[model samples]
Target chain A: MSRLSKKERQKLLKQVIKDNPFLTDKELADKFEVSIQTIRLDRLELGIPEVRERTKTVAQNAYARLRSVNEGEVIGELTKLKLDNYAESYLTTTREMALQKTPIIRGHHIFAQANSLAVAVIDAEKVVTGSAEIKFTRPVMVGDVIKARAEVKEIKGKKYFVEIKIYKDSDLVFYGDFTMFKLENGGV
Target chain B: MSRLSKKERQKLLKQVIKDNPFLTDKELADKFEVSIQTIRLDRLELGIPEVRERTKTVAQNAYARLRSVNEGEVIGELTKLKLDNYAESYLTTTREMALQKTPIIRGHHIFAQANSLAVAVIDAEKVVTGSAEIKFTRPVMVGDVIKARAEVKEIKGKKYFVEIKIYKDSDLVFYGDFTMFKLENGGV
Candidate 1:
């Protein structure tokens, strides 16, 4: 038979597991008449996060797992980095976080917090922002405790890019990038 | 009169308004000891917005002001823009916002809310994410409402670059962004 289309393969795979949540990859392979590897590939494409290590990710904060940083970690001081995620940074209004009277704390402070954490976790001491895009999905206000989690997504030559997500608790309030440049000294 | 350095001009301008809450253009000119035309030019160069009859922006919703949505005013309709003067936003948990959550709301819902708002306020209808640099600054759990804001700094042809900030009830939560793209008719 001609090779099945990607869409067709996915449809067939979904149908096989429509009744059960615990279908094994091998079982899926047997029913779909495909190799286990193909089934696994399909699962990945479908965004079905593997069930094997749910705790490693789901149990602990996704941010903590990505980096060595522990869950519920708080940054006490924003140290200096010659270059931040992007050559830019949020400087003012940071002190206003976690205050009362202001119905909403402010968005800039959140952005700064994200940027600061990204810079702190860098492997290179001097890194700059090459380019980035971010989506602001919610309102952050004063007194809200913010925790930043970041991961190194890719390392290409001298350029390193990381993905960071900010959560007030379970809600992902912010998401963006931290672009860092590796210094010639090899210190991050 | 000799031209002033950037620093000197800034200091002089500050001295003029040392105690006043506001300064008129003519008043600014006299204080700076420069022509009205010079003061006007300085204001533009410094990115100072002119105060007028103080027409409220069409969209007054937290997102609209932060993103700077552009459209005819529609009373009672919240602004969709996502940036404000201070790159700020306010936040309260769903329990606090006292608003019902929709199905579209998810881990990425808050992020998408602010991102989409930012995109909607862009001068063009067509837009795409060029890249994103982010960090998850705080834990946004259920019941926490976040306020977010972003600013546009650089504009290159179809590209509208920006910086953003987020907060949760007077607390600084998230911030960042160095670039964005304004598509030509939705074509990449």
Candidate 2:
């Protein structure tokens, strides 16, 4: 990072953020030993969007694929989906999610977010959950936002093992491991 | 029901609804071989609320337990909860849960409601999900109301296996088998 030429640095920057789109410009600058402005210029010159825009594009692309292929479901506000790889979504507990007249959100809702994110990450037109193991570490309340990220840990024939974790800000509130069945091509 | 006296019929009605709180008045009327009005009268005489109200009380009781016991979560509006036995909740898809700018509800929100109900049904000072296997059968639209019911199928030491299902009216939309961990008394 320190000794690369301008073109090489820009290429590496692209790869780094492409791999992990949540990195801030300031963080990139620190890693690259450059000013934030320099990082921004590199992003612009390379025709790359900011971290937020990058995620929006990934999520939007996944939606487009779902639309084109015909069937799939994604719950929560999908923020990013790289099918067959990983996906993430955001959900904020609303009053409707709380126990009637109470502010604490139901635990299943947290699992739902994680489980659905796991489902969304599958690279198939149709996927169904086969089973799950999950844990809730903390409680979520109405108006609190959670980001659920799911990654495909392994795929065996038609069976996909997905791992999901949810955070309220940086606080981990939920976790899930899902076994999903891809029902494409007669389940292969 | 025809052979029983009025008091006996009423007693059975109360117990039936207590065991399964979602039975509609019409269903009860059919089961009792009595008119809807007669079922209503029996409900009122027995001091048992209407099906909707009955669920509300059960759900509210669970919420109260959560508050006093200091942990546990319910994501969807809990409709009913019988700790160490069963619980159910309701959720409606909102625009926030859809893919960005799309009307399709994300898959995870469906799981969230069911998973939360599973968490709310445990009789414990603290509980966490251990794992789950889930399947999505149909797409959920914005404004669609889903009923998620979780039943404690078995318990082994501190681990509980809960089965959850989500229905849109009578249409089964999702299913999950969950492994949950109840963390009380050092996990017993």
Candidate 3:
């Protein structure tokens, strides 16, 4: 490892990070058998952001591409979205969402989260749901943290087909396929 | 008009009421140039129910064919439902449904009503929303009386495609296209 030149180590560092984006600077330093300062310098020279910044960039890019729904209108905290591509969100069910006499969250609450994500993924001036098919494999309960992922499957004219899956921990809880229609920005 | 026989008048009355179910007994009596009592007697002889009963029957038939959702679980007052055909529901937004600092009802409430109507129209032991495309054409305010209608547009195997429209005072306020999945009665 000591025989490796600075240029060679920087190249390897870049590849390792691309493979595993969560690694810390200290970990990279240890793997490269170099001092932490050297790793930091290499990262700065290569214009590579820190892990936190890297993660934030993905999320920011997603939000920036959103056009249909406002940030507050999104049912859950949208974690990431790429226009006409893929998106992610996180929702923690509240006590008020519980069904009568049960801890299970109301079905509509789940649908709202998934539906909003589908609309947000469309890169358009406005979007409409043309239709959807959905299923719930398990009940989500109050206080359960759910994660949702959406992917655009196809686009035909002004229509977009999106698929969304929601999970609680590792369990698949809900699924939805949305057909969205993109509308012109203004009537004029 | 007096020269017309009773049978001839009753036959015309039947056809007229069929064309316009909302006409009252008084209106019919005036139109037929007969007393209200005579129209009532004629309706009884013809096995035609009162207008209120006629409307109630349509609503009752709709609610009766519902198997996928319990009446209480429905988001709005399910007025009429015919399994695998068409259905109607009415929802009046309450004060609690109003958004913060605005009298407008939240978008999710409108979606809940449409989604529940979609699920309730499926004549299955159990039903799941496979996906939907939806739009809020106008903001629904608190105390707004909204009417929703759903029709089964198509079906393929275990899937049902439904179209739903909502109106507030004859203005189209919302729309949804839903794809629903029917699950078997028992996991056993």
Better of 2 and 3 by TM-score: 2
Structural similarity to truth (TM-score) of each candidate: 0.31, 0.57, 0.49
Using TM-score, give the best candidate's number: 2
Q: Model 2 off-target regions past 4 Å?
A: A1-11, A22-35, A67-73, A76-114, A117-127, A133-188, B1-11, B30-35, B67-73, B76-114, B121-127, B130-188
Q: Write the per-residue lDDT of candidate 3 for residues A80-124, one digit (tens) a residue.
A: 877889888878799877534456676789988987898788887
- What's chain A's TM-score in each predicted model? 0.46, 0.64, 0.67
In model 1, the number of clashes is 96
- lDDT values, one for every candidate: 0.47, 0.72, 0.77
lDDT of 1: 0.47
Task: Report the C-alpha lDDT of model 2 over A66-100, residue by residue, as the tens digit.
Answer: 42123234446676767778777777679866655
B54-95, model 2: which lDDT tens digit per residue?
A: 767766765775521232345566766577787777776788
- Candidate achieving the largest DockQ: 2
| Model 1 ranges off by over 4 Å | A1-95, A98-102, B1-188
Which 10 successive residues of model 1 chain B have the least lDDT summed? B97-106
Ten residues in sequence with the least summed lDDT for candidate 3 chain A: A179-188
- Which ranges in model 3 have alpha carbons more than 4 Å from their true place? A1-62, A185-188, B1-88, B92-108, B115-145, B149-188
